[model samples]
Target: MSTHKPLGRFLTAGAVAVAMLATAACSGSTEPSSEVTELTVILANSTFTENLPALAETYKAETGITVNVEAYGNEQLNDTLKVKLNAQSDEFDIFGYQVQDVMREFVRNGWLTDISDYVNNSGDWDWNDFQESARDAVQLDGKVYGVPVATERHIMYYRADLLKEAGIAVPTTIDELEAAAKALHNPDKGFYGIAMRGARVPLVTQYSSFLYSYGGDFQDEAGNSTINSEAAVQAYNTYGRLLHNYGPPGATNMGWVEASAIFAQGNAAFYLDADSQAYTFLDPQKSAVVDQVAYARFPAGPAGSHPYNIVFQTLGINSFSQKKDAAFDFIKWVLNKDNAKLLLGEHTLPVARSSAWQDSSATEKFPAGLVEIVRDTDSNYVGHDRPQLEAVARAREFVGGPAVTAIEGGDEAAVKAAAEQANTEFQALLDTEKR
Candidate 1:
């Protein structure tokens, strides 16, 4: 496993222009030449995408194809790709995507080319090696749109020493979670019950676990908004009460990084987010509760623990790119079994390959039973962290407003009113997209 290199800073407007200039210089001609083709692959700067430059070098050496890898922060990359794809510019041949993040809009706008034929004819690629949930995430209208790069699921992180001292068993249900939190909370000792994501955008991802567990979804089966359902109202109230009454002060302002820091400092008993962040909680250099931390499945609600199992990263070619074949070759090359193993070993994060998870050498890299827990959540919990929609950003914003209000000590009536208003506006957005 190679050490992950620090990602380049976010591309400024001028930086984007400079990157474009570099790509133009490398791209020999608009038409594919038999000699060599320089491919521009833009991806979010993540552990999953961090080693791409090395892989690109390998690809370039094996085949005379130069892959110019450009990495950006998640939100920044999403916005940049959206802008470039909408303009139908040939700035990039391939880009990394999140099925939950932008796939709905990208697919709807015809910005992504259908790779069904490529997937069907790839004899060397074992499609069955992918988990069904992961495979399903990258599909639309029964067509394979992209290859799964990596998968993530929400899991509970808890302070084992604190739980035992408080005489609380591991919480398995929402009621149990609240009771344990109340019992463990001690402001005088500077310990809070749970450090949860409460800020707007970050709140949505963690909140979705609670929402689905309560038998509420962002949209109903027919694709209409259900943000104000009775189940949703109850879920929001519970989610709000847990943090408002028992969480650390200024809980409403905390995102993943902030909340995780609180937990890592041993100030909170429980923190729930993507399981991939376990390394941060267990790393001795970064965490005060290093050896005291433990993992658990997301606590159950009325509907049971339907934690979000999202394929957080995927790779696909641009619909407007002339070098679709070359892009396809790049994707296939990057996702091959050996390369997948290399990424899993280097990143120590979960990849989309089923075989990678089951391999003893890869499993040994994680804490005991942690690998099995991840595999369990990945297979059993079949839900997304966010609503799947073309207007996903707008939808998250609408509902996130109420989430902020509810989590910040608003009364039940106020939360209900906000939910109702958000539901109406969200439905309107969905309706417009439908038309």
Candidate 2:
């Protein structure tokens, strides 16, 4: 039985500022108070929660600073952060920001504290340890806004046994991929040719990978929306074809959980999803096709291969935190190679540090194919931004709405029109944020 407790009260910026001042005043007294300083931290409820508290406990043992850690589910954490920011409050000294797109808005609004100086000044901190794409996602202007924790790249996970049985080699191009999907599809046996995330947000992330691969970008380097370009339409049309022809029947409602489950259960021939799923599909305890799973790079599109790679949740210190020094110390300690190794070993999450990736223990735990997937992440990394975010949401809506209509024997012209309309709405949203 899992017992859950209500997370503590949200801290507002005003309240945090008052607390800092109070702590400072108390520290100046002749009789130094022996009371422990409590720092509030809000983190998403995921694999992170399993280990962060233990790490916090270690920090307290060494420094006497007590950390009150609270965990919220993904949507809950985002909602809470937005509400707190809207109220101009800093209830938590440290926040775990998920999507880079959302973090950009937080950075723009001055909600997150800039950690560049601290990272630069720290003798132990190595900025080069992080992947360039992962680091770039958290940077606003020239200042870094967050410390990335884990990064995952999109890849094609296929059943090597099934491919061998079907007499098809591993696919390198989009056409080859489609042919393989068709060859391996067994609908009567509850199998799917391809399993992709079809739920709104998840589907959008999957689409971004393909869209970029097809030489379609959400925005140009100058920040103008490019989602309505011919390349983009082609990418969307291809996505519609996949859903309509080869994908799982219930794909529209499928997210990572469903897609991963389909692959793990050996009911899907191929899965286009994050590299993180490799661990699950290869785990004997969790997967029926543990020995049969094989990974390949994201299939190449007409334009080229432009798979999406993104760091998962990243932690950032609140700019309003009076305990900036303490915060820096905390992040540096947790992100250290030794600590990172432990986290990765326990959670199967990729660490931000490159050195950690080379750890002998890690190599023993993860597969060589998985390591190749991580290394290949550099080849097709695309930083998530507002345009990507908006375009993804719009793409998903258009797909599930009119695209589904077309798939179920509705009007193709109407589906195309709806897709165009969705693109226009997404472009308008992007326009509002342009500098």
CA lDDT of every candidate: 0.79, 0.69
Where in model 2 is the C-alpha error above 4 Å? Answer: 1-38, 86-91, 188-190, 199-201, 283-286, 385-416
Best by lDDT: 1
Residue 34 in model 2: shift from native, Å?
Answer: 15
What's the true lDDT of residue 314 in model 2?
92
Model 2: worst 10 consecutive residues (lDDT sum) = 22-31
Q: List the residue pairs that clash in candidate 1.
A: none
Top-TM-score structure, candidate number: 1
Q: What is the lDDT of candidate 1?
A: 0.79
- lDDT by residue (1-435, candidate 2, tens digit) is 012222112223432332232222211122232443767788887666656777677666655778888999888988998888777665567888875547766776777877776666554446777777888777777788888888887888989998898789999988799888887787898888888876645566777776787887766777655655667666666766676677778776778998789889988888888887776876688899989999888888997777876878898877556565566556676676566666665556687677667776755677777777675567357766224442344434543443344344334565567556766766576666663
